[model samples]
Target: MTEPADIPSPERVLDAGALRALAHPLRVRMYDILSQFGPQTASSLAQLTGESSGATSYHLRALAKHDLIREVAGRGSARERWWERPRGSVSFTNPAVMKTPSGRAATQVIMSEFLNRRHQQLMRYVGDSIKTPEDLYDAAAVISSTTIRVTEEQARELAEQLTKVLSDASDRFRDQEGEGVVPFSLRVDLFPLPPESN
Candidate 1:
């Protein structure tokens, strides 16, 4: 699936200011919505979020202050500005930021919101799988889980390998555009299970 730009390059880590700016629940949701759905006016986002346009507009300005989102060039008027997430990956792991109490709380909010959004999407897809077209279903749709034992170093290697594969594929197909083109979410989770309780 084509991201809005050339390649899914190195992730940009959020500084304390940006982290605090996005710590709000609504802001986090707005950020995710923009990443998934592309550009939108505050009015449009308000409708999708069930929030007042005034509120959405205010929060949008806050997000923009940290460069989390930017106004679409030459699009929309002063009364109706369009905004979109810049094309790139962003990492929430900031060691310096995490040392502060506020930063830790902000990270918790951000991660929780993101995970909830992803889970909602997955559930929706699973619920609608039966109604999905056979061709689309068979082509590139799957839900799978496998557990295996691995050393900590091995787990790190596996994560890197899988990331490289996905990034390569994303870079290769990022410029493809046509009638049938659409966005797709590619997810990969590689983590060790917790120890059994005594």
Candidate 2:
């Protein structure tokens, strides 16, 4: 199990090569699935994602090269090799280390693929459960905008507070052992006005 309070920000932007390794849609799908389901064999993932064993194995290797996934211990013959995500969550700097045009393209492809997979998952959950009451589904949404007059220092402090709150919440659920049917996401984003507007 992971500790929410221990979640760490990315210390360095991913290099072009690492980003390229992760630039595939299938790879992103594999990462997301493994992150949520724990360690799984290539055959099992292929079955779940409707991809061939060879393809899944190839992508899993690529993800491993990027330190995004790794093989877990198991037996031989009937023994299946398993894989898992390196972390519960990942965050990175805006300008990744892309030394060339191809590198930039690869980064774009990977990010787009990851985002699309997330969107699909969200849509599926919403479609299946939107009609259910909040108590039944454990779902809630709040939209609020604030007009604040604050300096850059204040904004940074606010961001830190928000991150701490989220980390605390994630920690609270880290050890949940099949006690409930609730699935939830705690997403938070903060952005400042563009230079011209500012």
Candidate 3:
């Protein structure tokens, strides 16, 4: 399918090489920071991650080698370079990637880590929610779910609708240049739960 010019693109299906490059927890953390805050230097990431600048530089180069991230042109001097992801996000949507045993394993590892990170962030917010402005506390808090019988088609449709709404909202606010804006994370997971008796 052709990618549209305006909207944020769906994640490119990862090849084995790209998946392997991005499989590290620290590297994925670097990617997350870049996604949230735009261009950053390896040293800055190193400070946030508590790694040496040298190590962060090494990982950043690996990410660039696989084209998952790239160096921002003319952004820094000889000692430091800026890095950013061309696409703000990515996914392992290609069937080919999962067809290989290593690819499947790596994909699962990354996906699990991503979800685990999300849950951690959610917990952090919950802890801090009480201290936040009341308006933000009221308007920005929600965590509710339910279980109901649904055909496969119905489930797929519901997921798609939710995704479309989130995508539209993201498109409206992406790449802002104005001040007083905060970076927010949105997590939407939809999968059948284990049987009630299990």
Indicate the residue-level lDDT of 59 in model 2: 88
C-alpha lDDT of candidate 1 relative to the true structure? 0.85
TM-scores for the candidates: 0.88, 0.71, 0.87
lDDT of 3: 0.79
Better of 1 and 3 by lDDT: 1
Sorted by TM-score (best first), the order is: 1, 3, 2
lDDT of 2 by residue, 1-198 (tens): 332545554333566666777777788788878866667888999999999998898888888887877776453234567787754445422364555678768877877887777778767766666666564346564435676778999989999999888867655664356766354655566778666763
Residue pairs in collision within model 1: none
Window of ten residues with lowest summed lDDT in model 3: 1-10
Candidate number that wins on lDDT, 1 or 2 = 1
Q: Which model, 2 or 3, shows the larger lDDT?
A: 3
In order of lDDT, best first, we have 1, 3, 2
Local accuracy of candidate 1 as per-residue lDDT tens digits, 83-165: 99876678886999999899899999999988888899888877677677674467577788999899999999999999888
Report the error of model 3 at residue 30, Å: 1.1
- Give lDDT tens digits, candidate 3, residues 1-198: 212437676646778898888888988788778877778998899888899999999999999999888888877988888888775346654578888888888888787776777788888877677677674556655777778789999999999998888777666666666687787887677898886784
**Backbone clashes under 3 angstroms, per model:** 0, 0, 0
